[model samples]
Target: MNSFLAIIGRELRIGFADLHRVVTPISFFAVVLVLMPLGLGPSPQLLAKVAPGLVWVVALLAILISADRLFGDDMKEGSLPQLMTLSLALPWVVLAKMLAWWLMAMVPLAVIAPILGMMLGLSTEAAVITFLTLLIGGLGLCLVGGISAALTLSTGAGGALVALIALPLYVPILIFGSAAVEAASLGLAVKPYVLILLAFDFLAVPLAPVAAAAALRIAIDD
Candidate 1:
């Protein structure tokens, strides 16, 4: 457990050192959320109508862009192989790395969401709900992104390939998460939406590390 913590800390330190990649997508997460109002004009009805889809689209795109950095750096430096051989448990290592990756890429977007949400004319309640939904949904996004990252690491087209593969899977998250917010605005119950988000995340979280580790093994073997 201590080793896993240290490894997570070490990876986070490395991620900070590699801020150029991490920060840009986080920035885009904010930029894209704010783009719709500017592009389509800022009317409350329209913003409410499109906000969910727009948020989902931005979240998906941000995840896609950020996937390239997941295993690419470790694979380049041969650290992935070393991690694979360690007794600390490869799944834990993969989880730590994915969490670090999420912190670098997704957490920032959550923090900055309210500021961006205002541009879409979301009410205080709706903005908070949107942030919460994205928080949960983004975990699944990162987990799935980790898998895609591992799968495509060798191809060097990791970003594009990840987007192609992930987009279909991302649809449910986009639909449910955004639907949650849109539902909230109408005074409807959002528990169902939250539960669905959790179901998706629960499904992805466990499988992601295994899949990523498998991809890493393949990467090392090849």
Candidate 2:
């Protein structure tokens, strides 16, 4: 756990160093949530119908925003070069960083879920399920988005590349997460959806880091 925890703490401290950079994207998540009620004219019916997609969409974008910066510092400071030659497998290290990144970005999104839910006219049950979906699904985003960041670290257009690669990957989670809430709103069982999200977590959590480590090695290969 030494390098892993060290990476987590290092990544997290760097993540928050610039408070504006650290918090602004999440503010975007919240602002998008806040604006929906106004845009939809505050009709509870309208809000209910659109809330799930809106929340997932904004959450997706929030993950994308943070993904680009995940490896920026390491790349800039030549740490990635050193990392490539480290004895440890790179993916686990990258995964640890993703965990920290998720904590910084996605957890905030979850914390603000109720407020976002209310703005979208989410029913109590729908809101709870949506929050659960996000809580589970956001980990997958961090894993996948982390790999996207690692894959693009040397490209000089990390942000654009991250969005291009990761946004499409996020679609399934978005679809299911929103669909789960829709099912909940309709009084249907959300068990399948939750299970799907957990499955995603199981797959992405282990696999994405390995892929990210490989990508980092490739990107830094001289």
Candidate 3:
């Protein structure tokens, strides 16, 4: 328990030390939302209709943009091998790092998602749902993306490869996340979609770290 908290603290410090890791995803998320109006033209009805999907898709991509770096710094600093040898379980360590990354990266995106959704013409109800979905669904994104990052850690692949590996896995989250907001926008019941997204996060929280830890071992051994 102490060790898990310590790992999370160390990761948070490292993440804060390098601002790019913290800033890039948020910037990408905001920039894309800002430009969307230009590309799609200023039609409130159209933007409102598509805001759910648009926010979700951009958030997914924003999370993916930084996903490859989840394990990059640890590997480069030779800390990954040492972490594996710790008294604490490697899955716990992986979970700690994922939590830290979610805090530094996903939280900011989730926080701003409602504002961006409104810019895209989402109603107050839909915007609130947008924020909720992104906050929960982003964890699923980080966990699944962490697995991809661990799998390709030794290959020195960039975000492109990470996205390639994780995109298919991301489909369900995107679907449910966007659907929730869309349902809210239409004044329909959003509980079902929100529940599904929560289910994904619940499953990912315990399982993803183990899968990622195994992948890390393989990457380390190779």
- Each model's lDDT: 0.82, 0.84, 0.92
| Top-scoring candidate (lDDT) | 3
Candidate 1 lDDT tens digits, 1-222: 888788778977887887777788877887777666778886789987777667767877977887877888888988988887888778889998888777777778877775677577777777788889888988988888888888887777776798887788788888898898888777788999999999999998888899888888887888
Writing each residue's lDDT as its tens digit, candidate 2 over 103-211 gives 8888878878866786678888888887788889999988889888988887878888888998888889999998998898889999999999999999998889888
Ordered by TM-score, highest first, the candidates read: 3, 1, 2
Of 2 and 3, the candidate ranking higher by TM-score: 3
Model 2 local distance difference test score? 0.84
The candidate scoring highest on TM-score is 3
Report per-prediction Cα RMSD to one decimal: 1.4, 1.5, 0.8
Q: Backbone clashes in each candidate structure, one number apiece?
A: 0, 0, 0
How far residue 193's Cα lies from its native spot in candidate 1, in Å, is: 0.6
Q: Any runs in candidate 2 off by more than 4 Å, and if so which?
A: none
Off by over 4 Å in 1: none
TM-score of each: 0.94, 0.93, 0.98
> CA lDDT of 196 in candidate 1?
98
Q: Model 1 scores what on Cα lDDT?
A: 0.82
